[model samples]
Each structure stands twice: as structure tokens, then as C-alpha cells.
Target: MMYPPPESQSLKTLLPETPILLMGSGPVPVPQEVATASSIVISHLGETMKKIVARVQLMAQYVFQTKTTKIFGISGPSSAGMEMAIGSLLWPGRKVLVLNLGTFSARFAEMARGVGAEVKEILPQGLAPIYIEQVREAFEKDSFDVLTIVQGETSCGVKNIHLKEIVELAKSHGVLTIVDAVCTLSTMPLPMDEWGIDIVFVGGQKGLSAVPGISLIAISENTFQFISNRTQAMPHWCLDPRRAFKFWGLGEYHYTAPVTGILALHEGLRLICEEGLEARFERHLKCSSALQNSLEAMGFSLFTPAEFRLNSVVAINNLSNVNTKELISLLIKECHVEISGAFGLDIIRVGQMGEQSRFENIERVIRALAFGYGKFGHKLDLESGLKVLNISRDSGKK
Candidate 1:
């Protein structure tokens, strides 16, 4: 018996010769340092790995704006991080109040239901963000064991501006809060401890600009106590934080940890700390405002209004004359730039996440969008849009 020989291919033709620019909803380009970190893989149980893991936790706390040491990285995506929160906290007959705002909120409800929890969702139809009054009404109407919400809805670029207030109301009703900050953390201000958030999770691919596959999760002391006293065992062992903490917290073996992803996440969090949260927020805001204004000037409509729009990801409505799918093709195939089409929505999303929010990339994306629109036989105010972008860049220097 012998192993079969492998087929051979030219390395030159293995990938696209021209680098495709990632201006999409997530998995945006990582910085040089973060990319370099991902290549350094050491023994998962070694002392060097322990220090990296500790630094990651400390940096994650800084990014999450929390003092809780319960923060740790998950070997899966944000959904896995969220699954840990949902499965560990809820069991059969438990009730959850879902402030259904967008795609991810709907997913939270589905995941809660899967855990045998009673799910009640309050969805504000259309592109509007969930109002505080709606949340207040839900709390007053019935008692719930937990409340889950998204700080920023990635699907349509809508954000809950009243997140802190909503969390306070939930706490008043004795309901624990779990926030999905996958697209918001490090890109904007989400003071977890300050707002009394019980459980918070983030995806490294978006705001943190790390490659996909690793996500961060944190829990408050109160939430930890609740999980510790759960009636049933957690639904999953790999997704459970109690098992994960043995490796991330106590420096022990849990699984063959994704060392590369952890190192990349560590670098991402370090970059966020080095830039400082305030400056990072300002950068995202500056770039997003410019991108939004430029799009509007080019006669493109946005999915959500500026007041409650998510800055990290901006959704551009597919106008009556242009199909978003076709436009996305033009952006990718011809323009060498890429964006995302909303699932079952007449909108497309362009990312304003970490490296995507860089000034030069912002300009490049705007120019590529203009080119795509022109190719589709739709004349846009390209000069006007560029003028607005230039003005924003100049004003930002002050």
C-alpha cells in the first residue's frame, strides 16, 4: 500500500494575478503587521503561546472597553462566539426578548429557539432601527430571562443609537443583556462595562481587520454566575466558554487552538490599542461620512438615514435603473474592487471597516464605484462626488 501522487499546477496561475480590492461588508484587508503575525505559528501549549494569549485577552478587554477578564477568543466565526453565549445562557423554557433590527437579530432569535428557549422578537419593519420606546414596551409587557441585540446590523448598515438606554431598561427589568458587536467593536464606541452589557462578542474580520475564523467573546461577572448556575449543561463543548477558558485563561489544553488566528487577532487588538479607541472611531466616522456623502452626490441612495446608520458598513440602495448584482460584477470584474449585495434586499454594502477605511482606499473605492456606474450606462456626478470627498479629506486635517 502506498500514498497516491498529487496533481501539479503552476504557482503563477494559482490565484488571480491582479489583487482584488476588498471593499465589501467584511473580511476586509489586513494590515502588514497583522498579516505577518498570522504566519507565525508556535506550539499551542508553549510558554510563548501563553503570553500571546494573555496579551490578546488584555487587548480584547481594551477594545471591548470592559474590565472583565472573561474575554477570550473563539476558534470559529462570530456566529460561533454568539452560539456559545446563546447555548450557555439559555435552556429549555427560558425566555428571550430579541430586539429584532436586522439579519443578525433574526439569527439571534433562531439560535435562541434552537436552544429550546421561548423567543419573542420585536422587529421594526423596513430600514428603520429599533426604537427605545419599542424596547421599553417589550420590557413592560412581559418578563424575560435575557435580552439579545445587535449594536450595528451588518446586513443593512443600521445601528441602534439607543443601545445603552435599551440595555439599562433590560437591566431594570432584571434581564441580562447580550450584544452582538461583530461589526461595531474597535470601529466605534461600545463601552460594555459602562453600559452594563452582560455578554458581548465580536468578529475579528470586520472592524478589527483580522482574517476570518477567529472571534472574541466576553462575559460579565453577573453573567458568569448565571451560567455557572445553569440547570442544564451547555449544549456544546467546543463552543462553551467554560471549556475555552481553560486554554485562554488558565494556559491549559482545550483543543488544538488556532495559533495563527490568535496571533493575528492579538496584532489587530494591539493596533486598535495603539491607535486608541477615540482616534479609531474618528477615523471610521471620517471615512464613512465621506463615502456616504460621495455616494449620495453620485445619485446613489443609502439604505438607512445618517442618524442611525452603521458607520462601519454602508449600504447603497439599488436604484430603479441599476441592478445591484450587475453593479457588483462590474465592481469586481472590471474595476478590481469588491462590495457586497444584501441578501434578498435591493441594496449593496461597501465596508468602512479597519483597513478599508484608510484614506487612499476610500478614494479608490469611490472612483471604482463611479466607474462601475458609468459602465452600466448610468451617468453619475463623478466630479461632484470627488469634490465632496476632497472637501471631507481637507476638513479632516483640522
Candidate 2:
């Protein structure tokens, strides 16, 4: 007899009865279309599954504006996407240059080292964007087989806007380029084919507004040939990109695919297409900008520079008068709102990814922050925050 799927409560379900706003780094609230798709029943390895996979791949192509690049779906989070991209290209004798900006970029370096590839990191100073001049200097000094960079550094809420130029520079040096677009995919400007990116990976949950457990990877023909030429076996069978391509490209199944996650991603991509990429990006920008303006008006400073701030996540420096940890706890306990604390900085992050990138949603978060700060012996200017929201709405932003 077949057993039913195991029953468990998700984090969202475990929260209190109050309506909680998820303005944190990842796993943003899914859109209604995605939630509906998640409830659909489907087999994991059948014709229906094949159709869903193809649809997801096509949607990825449309979202990334790629024509001929091969796309693959992995049955894991964006971390698995990173490993797949790195493990597919890295070998014992290869040199990998990693542009280190925040925690995730460091993880890329670690993955390269794990594969026994000689890794060199070009680290920026204090959460700043990795400059093209720095990358040029690194390239002048040494030769590299592959160069990896994160398009959006979620840990610090910074977006490296010089990616297209960087890709061209890497091409000039005959170095393969890889990008981690986990937080920027579908929410920012990332044209894989136009930029000539060799390999890039994005999370299904962050900007796609789908449920977690899926990673999408796009590969160019040149990168595919490099993987095809590898003679030695991969250290992990699950991380083999060629095998994954066969599984996604052909009907051969390597492992059980997450049917519900794929369905959610399909619906999320459908919504994105319906909304239009430019419109969706504008929505994120307006909402994030308004939130930042309100926060600044309330005497909180932004963590990232104005020129390099990401449109999806906002990092605010903690106030000296109020205990941040206590304020965060009180917000969750009393207001039922959740924001994220930075890994090694005195900052809190608010995300405006996908469906949560709305004026009212951001206004709610501001109100929650005001309430939490007030309860913690700090009087924030709630009227000023609300006024910003009103002006943003009246100005037809978002």
C-alpha cells in the first residue's frame, strides 16, 4: 500500500493568528496564483511533469530574455543552484576568481575551494559594490578559468550595476563568467543572453514569489561544451549539470522532481509575464524607495549607498537609542511582523520582493516599525512615514 505524504506545518502556518508581514530576505509570500498552483495534484515523473518542466524553462527564458541558452531545474534551493554551477565548471587544476561582496559571495568561494579549484577572491571594502576597476586590476595580475560574482548581495542590500561591463571584460580575458541572481531574477534587469553570461542561477522563491525548493540555472553553449569535455567524475552525483540537463532536457529522470514547487514556479512566472517585467521592476523600485524614504525620515540610516542599493531588499542601520534585538522580538511578539537581521552588521533588512512589493504592504511594515520603536522607548515619526506613503501613492508610484 502507498503511504500518504507526510504532514507538517510550514513556518507561515505556525505563526500566530495575527496577519504577519514577511519583509525579510527570502521565502517571500507567494502570490495567489502560485498558491493555487501549489495545491494542484500531479505525478513527479510523468508526461504532466515534463510539460510543467518545459513550461518553467520557457518562462525562465522569457523572464531572462534568453533565446538559446539551456535551462535546468534543480530539486533544491538557490544554494544548490550555486553548487551546481560551480561543480559543473570547476576541476582540480582550474583557477576560479570570486568577487566577494557579502556572505553569499563568500559561499561561492567556499564551494570553489571544496571542488579543489584554486580560488582567489577580490573582496570589496565594507559592503560596497565590487568596482570594475578592481576586477580589471585582478585580471591584469593573474589568469583565471572562471570568474563568479553575485548580481544582488542580499546580505547588504546592494546591486552591482556594472555586470554587463564586467561580463564583457571577462569575455575579453577568455574567462568564463558565472552570476548568482538569486534575489534579482524577475525583479531587476538581468538579460542573460544580452549580457553574454556563461552560467547564471536564480532562486524560485525570492523574486519569483514561488515556494522554496527549486533552483533555476541557465547555461550557454560554450559552458555546456566545457562541462561536456570534463573527463573526471563529479564529486557529487546530484550536482552534475550535464546530468541535470539530460533530466530536464530529455525525459530521463535522475531524481524525483518537486512537482508542487515546479507548479508554483510556473504560476509565478505566468504572473510575471502578465505583469510585464518592466512594470514589475518599477513596482519593486517604487515600493523600496518609498520605504527607504520613510525610514530615513524617521532618523534611520540606510546601510547601503544610495547609488548601489537593491530594489528588492533594504538594509537599515540600527538605532543607537533602541535595542535592535529587543525591538525585533517585540515586533514579532506584538505586531506579528518579521524582518531579518544582518549576519555580521547592526542592520535590519526589509524585502519588497515579488508579490510583497506593494505600497500598502510596505506601509504596513513602516507602521509596524513605528509601533515597535515606540514600545521600545523611542518615538518614531509615524506621521512622517504615513505622509511619505500618501505622497508615493498620489504620485502614481507602485
Model 1: what TM-score? 0.96
Please, what is the TM-score per model? 0.96, 0.94
Collision pairs in model 2: none
> For model 1, how does the per-residue alpha-carbon lDDT over 1-398 read when each residue is reduced to its tens digit?
99988988889887767888899988999999899999997899979998998899898888888898888789899999889999988889899999887788888999999989999999875778888899888777889999999999998888988899999999988998999999988889999999999999988899999989999999997787678777687899898777887898899999999999999998898898899999999999999999999999988898898888899999888766778888888788887898999978888899999999987888888888878878778788888888988998899475
Give lDDT tens digits, candidate 2, residues 1-398: 99998898799877587766777888888878899999987877878888888888888889878874478878899999899988988879999999998899899999999999999998886767889999999999999999999998999888887888988999999999999999999888899888999988988889999888888888887788888898978877887877887678886878777778888889998999889999988888877888889888876789888988887889998877667777888888887778888887888899989977888778878988989878767788889878987788779625
Candidate 1 yields a Cα-based lDDT of 0.89
Q: What's the lDDT for candidate 2?
A: 0.86
Error of 2 at 29 (Å): 0.7
